[model samples]
Target: MNRKNFLSSLLTIGAAGPVLAAAATPNAVPSVSRNTAASSAALPTPLIIPPYLRPGDVIGITCPAGDITAKEILPATQLIESWGFRIKVGETVGKKDGVFGGTDDERAADFQQMLNDPELSAILCARGGYGAVHIIDRLDFSPLANRPKWIIGFSDVTVLLCHLHTNGNWASIHSKMCNSFPDDWAKAEAIQVECILSIRRALSGERMEYKVPPNVRNRNGRAEAALIGGNLKTIESLAGTRSDIDTAGKILFVEDTGEYLYSIDRMFWHLQRTGKLDRLAGLVVGGFKVKPDDPGEEFGQTVTDIVTARVKGYGYPVCFDFPVGHQKDNYALKYGIPHLLDVQEGAVTLTDTSVPAAATPSL
Candidate 1:
């Protein structure tokens, strides 16, 4: 079907209601009802971690969101290949249908193909713009249930990450995509180089840990639980959908770019009202590049003020200015995997506590 017709069909189904719309999709995974206020006890099944990549393992690159020319991903391919992994460029990489990488069907098919390809150890998103939600429900994740592979990217890809976590209990990488790759590696800033290299370390099965200077507003405490979250706006948008996250017993991290303080405050309020902030292992407030309020219309509160006001009653650790989000220092985070969040007056640290695949409990 053409894009226009497809969208119109969606609108018709949506008008009927979300349940009917989801039920109409043959391959759609049923949304699991969760207890948002569940205790912080360990889950019965540990998150499934896809096999770590090795020398010559194939990493597929597909454009599930926005358009990106083959020439643009050259730097990313060259760099990833340097890490001893082969690159399999998907058909949607250079294709364009309006601002999207391709038609929704095309992008979904490309990603589904990668997910089912046994040779592809990981699928790296070429970029994240505004189309991942358009194709998410259309793709079948049954293949991933049997042969899970690392799904990498952030921004719009947060929809995919959250869907994987909420529905399949699969672990994924939340990090920079192809668009963030530096064209000239030699001239890249120190932070850029470090962030890019962190992706390699994650896919190679290295235990991940990071430390950042503490903000005066940080609440000192420690908690260990599965870490989950991404762009705040994206998280808020997924509410009431199949991809909506369950934060009952997890360390949640949120970040965003180019939003007004009031908008940010509203999103936080949504979280609180929806019981997302009622119980948590901790909260990591990542880099938020708030847009300046218009003249004569300033929002009286800062990001920290807005956050602390909401979670003041919760005893879990709350740290600000975390090094994750749309910034040069944005580090890779393992979604669905258990992590240790330590907040102290002097510093904050997040550590991956994933066990060997053989030792991990299976679903």
Candidate 2:
């Protein structure tokens, strides 16, 4: 979609309602929040973030993707602090009017400033609501190229990840940030601590293996591949553009939140139709918060059902309910790390390839 239509779509989706969509099945009726298990008997381990985080690292929080709920800022900062890093809230952090976050110029500026800031160890987004596409076109990554650090967020920020992976960093994370972090950090401080520490490990080149919540039913094939993906909409948007992800032979992890089951199907359909979904050696679905249009048809085919329909015959292992989306218990995954995914005997273990420490940032 061109920038004009992209902007229009944002307004349209928002004017309709806040996102709370779920996949609906014709006969199944159940609470939407109930997590659906992956239909595949086993799954693979997700890629780990490069461990570059340290206690005193200065992290920059910017609003490049979407407008954050203004009220959530202070508390979000507290959550970042709870993880032990100080945050520099950008001038555009809370930029939002109706849906576009900030004026294209404003959002672009926030990203530009952070990319240029040498002191900021990483620039994390405040949210990913239908805006990054607008600003990405205007960005000049000279600063980012000079001082390479983590640029984190999911959903819309996937655009940034696509560009960064191809042109600059050779690494980044399609993980959580901003409003998404607080709820987790405030409660599971240690988990938050581990997450930060884990990212640090990935970045600093001290890679061993990160945690993957044990899955009883995982894809049994053991293979190594790169970690890549964010919201389905964002990834799908990359279709046809130069930044379209090359999923061929990679472990593709996909997740999204607040999408209608049909919309979810449509996005994946784009992937499938475009041959993007066909190349993956394995597929790991992140948390899906699917809502049905008709209350009577709650599990309208279910998230798993749609997933199975799209991926079942592809010959690659498919795992569902894996952590990588807009869920509270999502995992922090490195977008470019290579690791082993073993779904054997109903267990998924993501083992690192045992490479030397990750290269230090150029600047």
Candidate 3:
């Protein structure tokens, strides 16, 4: 199956089971606390900043999902190495087990080793296709919780980030992976440049802010809360699992690609029904690409319409077309860190509050 279909299919099956009940279980609930309270919790200190990559520091690249060739990652590896860091490719990079880069056990083992390694400054996924869900439950994140290294990627990697953020209270990047990097950095688009620079800023503990164009459906207001959410399909797949997000008083940013409008609607309804939409500080709707209706069927509402309708009564600020998701302009955002979202007439600004002014450079 193609990447999108594979994600959808796996998530839909998960939806069929006792998702609501499973999500509501006490152990599965996220610890949605304020700065002080969250710090007090036994949970791995929230927003734990991993050690930044320095010259000679090694970064381990592992394929926790879809199979990828060394050639596909060479460009990204070279770019990173040129930045003065070392690259340690995992065994799963070129290995294929059906649709996945490796079998569930194999992928888990590779990732576990990286998590346990002290020499690696970060572990980035080779790509996000589908297998993470199969191995999410098998992998132990306790080592990561202690070391708190940067874990990067999006789409299916949402499983890993969510696990670290919720269960481990660690900060992780929701950004491009090895597969997204262009071979020639000079040929990259403006948005691609933004994405790459943002990744660097995030790794270096730099704060980021976005000046986004306003949308008619956007709610005019402001909010400050921890950022969370990623691929809607993957988030849906995690509804009942341990990785499911608890969005209470948090800014939720969601984006998806290649799904039917009806399916998107259903997913939103599920989020609302499960209390995922309630009491949020704000919402950011990123790129919803190629959302076609099924044959002879129409959902009759744009994604903005669905979102605005769902959050109509709430006063929280809402912004649309924020440069994120499958698009090249997919700005890197820090999950589990506090941020400020100011939605005003004609424009919106999103600022990361966790990092200091001196630390956050313009990306």
Number of colliding residue pairs in each model? 0, 32, 1
Top TM-score model: 1
Global Cα lDDT for candidate 2:
0.61
TM-score of each: 0.87, 0.74, 0.86
The global Cα lDDT (0 to 1) of model 1 is 0.82
Worst 10 residues of 3 by lDDT: 4-13
Q: For model 1, how does the per-residue alpha-carbon lDDT over 78-134 read when each residue is reduced to its tens digit?
A: 999999999999999889999999999899899989988978889999998889999
Candidate 2, run of 10 with poorest lDDT: 4-13
Model 3 scores what on Cα lDDT?
A: 0.76
lDDT for 127 (candidate 1)? 93
Compute the lDDT of residue 112 as modeled in candidate 3: 84
How close is each model in CA RMSD to the real structure?
Answer: 8.2, 13.0, 8.6
What ranges in model 1 sit over 4 Å off? 1-44, 355-363
lDDT of 3 at 290: 57
Model 2 C-alpha lDDT per residue in residues 145-261, reported as the tens digit of each score: 234467877788888887655432245766666665454445666655555444445544455454355454445565566656777878887787645676666667888888788
